[model samples]
Target: MKFQDLNTAEERIQLMEKLSETFLSRAGKNDEEGLFPFENIKELKESGYTSLTVPKRYGGKEISLSEFLCLQEKIAEGDGSTALSIGWHMGIIKSLGEKNNWEESVFKDLCEEVKKGALMNNCATEPQTGSPTRGGKPVTSARKEEGFWIINGRKSFTTMAPVLDYFNVSAVIEDSGEIGNFLIPRNSQGLEIDETWDSIAMRGTGSHDLFLKNVRVKEEALVELFQPGKKGAAGWLLHIPACYLGIAQAAQTYAINFAKDYSPNSISGAIIDLPNVQQKIGEMELELMRTRHFLYSVAKKWDEANDETRSMMQPELGAVKLAVTNAALTVVDLAMRVAGARSLSAKNPLQRYYRDVRAGLHNPPMDDMTIQALAKSAIK
Candidate 1:
């Protein structure tokens, strides 16, 4: 069902819940085989979920930030890999729509493509440069040749590489010695995916390496220019924490279910009655509640803020990501404690949830960096 067809946020969320149930069923097989969830993505595109963040002027629902994160959390509950993978596309579309940084025609064209199921993600991380948030210059170089720009570089952590229709790559302009983002179509002459992803966590994300061997694009393909790590406040990044939070919620559900049904000969009732188990469950509920409030409150603020206000919210945004991601880790840990050793069984979803939740620590706005930003903000 098209997200636009739904008149209310609740209806849209219900649609996602229905889609997520199917994604949940295949999550285990995809995680076990390290297979990209192409089918899940296809289903999302068919449901018009992928284009929900496109601007209303572009005929999209343009859901509020709170609604976007809520939907993202729901998707993650079903499959963290698919949620994380698709989150990039959703957030990028929202960010671009909000920023209006690119050429009007160009962005409009891209939005049209998105409405037709086209997917794209930024590829910035490189082996030598590490995380792009660390202020490292991209080794990927772009040089102007005739009327086109030739780009050559390799990018790591290119999530959803398997089905991406477009790659927005960061590269240093050789002539101007400046960083720029180039929008390279998947059919670019020399663009290729290396299939090198092998991380133990988020195994189904397909975050493989991207290689550009003298790929050429029109000069207009240069979409954005900026200093590394200096981009303004990005509320869209909330999708990261939303994803982990959803995984934690899944873990909590599994743990509670396990607790209620698991009765041992040593106990007259289920272990959920035990004070220690009750304590863990209570702690999980507390953290989930706290983080959800923190996440959605900030999302609401972002939705209501003007550009000037939003630009100054970097510290708050970072805090939300830092708080929610870490809390999600805690929640999952407590859930695992509730389940005891059985949580680590290869067949158990908790094991998958545990691994997937940890991946959030490595996503953009790392804890250390966020703390430092908070300190800077406080001091300034």
Candidate 2:
């Protein structure tokens, strides 16, 4: 059955609750063992979570960004990798719908599969250039040949490569100087996964190298690369914030629970009773609340907003990403401080989350760049 056939958020929410609970319980084990959480992806695939963002026009549910953000936060609270990995799809498909770009026939077919819950990934990061922010400058190039474009390049950190049915891979179209996206089906000839994701955190995310050797795709399948401030294409600014906020909330909860239960031998009662400990908890909570309110409000506002708001939206989104990701890193650090020596143990959740949340600060449109842009926009 398709996503639209499901009827309401109530049905989808119920499905999410059950799957999220089970995945949450197993996420730690999977992370520790360096497992890809294929089981969680399978669980998501079986449910409607994979199709949750496809628009209503083509047999999809058309849920609001507020709802989408909530879903991601909840899942992330269970497992960071699971939430982050699936985000590429949620953010992209919805943005695509908003643009209404594809030919009706093409949209119909992709949306139909999306309706039944297929997953797509943004295969943008290449080994040569860290991210598109520096300029696509794709090391990969596609040459038009024999009624099809032949693509060739290497992409590292291709998250969800194992389970993705479709990939929105970017490659430069020679002669035209156009940076376009090609929808390459998974396991296409010459496409292979190089399982090299032995990271310190977010281990459950199957981010690996994608090897593309003379891969061919039809011209219509090539999605035009979007320039910043463009009308169509998934705006990178919008998606980054949700992931950061989710990580922040997770750190806050972990700290709260640890403080309540941990009775440091030096302290009288539980650590919760200590004045300094209480202050740390208070500060952490404050950070989490600020991020939550700001993020939720942005998602809500965007839901009812138009493109003319783009100018203002840039700073707003950048601020949230900066605030929430930094908060998540700080909150996790505080949790470690509160937990004391126990926090460093390999068994500790705080240890892993601390490392994981820090990645957000470096994820592109660097905080410095965003701050600079905000500063420049301020005087105007």
Candidate 3:
């Protein structure tokens, strides 16, 4: 379906369903070959999926947070890697536009580029600093030259690196030690993508390392300064949990179908007729429902909340990620159990789901931090 046909949420969903047919088919192959899903991303870009969250004033759809999460979950249901890869672009665009995080002229230019299928993501993690959320100054140093800032550092886990049009890199100013995110265009001098992504899960995401060896950009590229001790409620991160939940849903469906179809001479009927198998299915459904309710409710609440109300929701947001991700892991485990040892096969979708869902545990809003924040919130 053409993007012009997508005038409402339902139309957008229909388009996603159509695209998922191809994503679901290519998912296993991409995982096996450890290849990036370039075609899948192309489909998203051409279908205008990448621009869904760009502000409407920029001639884009500008879907709400809840709608964005819903679409993300839908894409993830087909391929976790594809969903996770693009989620960064969609979420960041919405968040940046809403917050006006960049200079007006630069942001307007970015929005226009997004409307024309441009994609971007934050490249914050470093070999030394790990997740930027852990509060370490970037070893990536930006030195002011005659009229530009020259950056030098290696950022790890630069998701969608193969297709990203922009890389918003975090670095400390060499002169004053002020930390900031520098917007580096993909074609900038001294910028390179090292094919270092070899993770066991989400292998198709192309989250390779980005090496900036004296990459220079105009000073206007330093979009936002980092305020170390302050943080706002980032509802856009709901995309992370939403992806895992989608993988869990896929696992659940696979197990159910396997139970219904797989039968042996030892049994009178399909395995699904067995009480043990039925129990697993029941548990998976319950967990999935709980996960969806927790995620969707929080996303809707974020949509309706003002800045003050949303700021206080940080704990709840962290809790949602903690709860939903853990629950997704459980659901996938149960699905694998229902599928038996065959699920461990290298080609099995369940195996892929198992590995992909586990990545969530390590994603930002780490479980330890979430628990600590919850504890602090409760005590106060």
Ranking by TM-score: 1, 3, 2
Over the stretch 1-380, how does candidate 3's per-residue lDDT look in tens digits? Answer: 66656678888888787888789999999999999999999999888788888887777778999988888888888999999999999999999877876888998899889878899999988888866786877889999999999999999999999999999998999889899999899999999999999999899999999999989899899999975435567999999999999899999999999999999899998999999999999999999998899999999999999888888998899999998899999999999999999999998999999999989998888898889889999999
Q: Point out where model 1 deviates above 4 Å.
A: none
Best by lDDT: 1
Ranking by lDDT: 1, 3, 2
RMSD of 3: 1.1
User: Deviation in angstroms for 118 in model 2?
Assistant: 1.4
Model 2 lDDT tens row, 163-273: 888888888888787777888888678888899888776787888888889988887878666552232222434556666666666666777788888775887778788
Candidate 1 lDDT over 155-196, as tens digits, reads: 999999999999999999998999999999999999999999
Model 3 accuracy (lDDT, Cα) = 0.90
TM-score of 3: 0.98
Model 2 residue 240 lDDT score: 60
Clashes of each: 0, 0, 0
TM-scores of all candidate predictions against the true structure: 0.99, 0.92, 0.98
lDDT of 1 at 117: 96
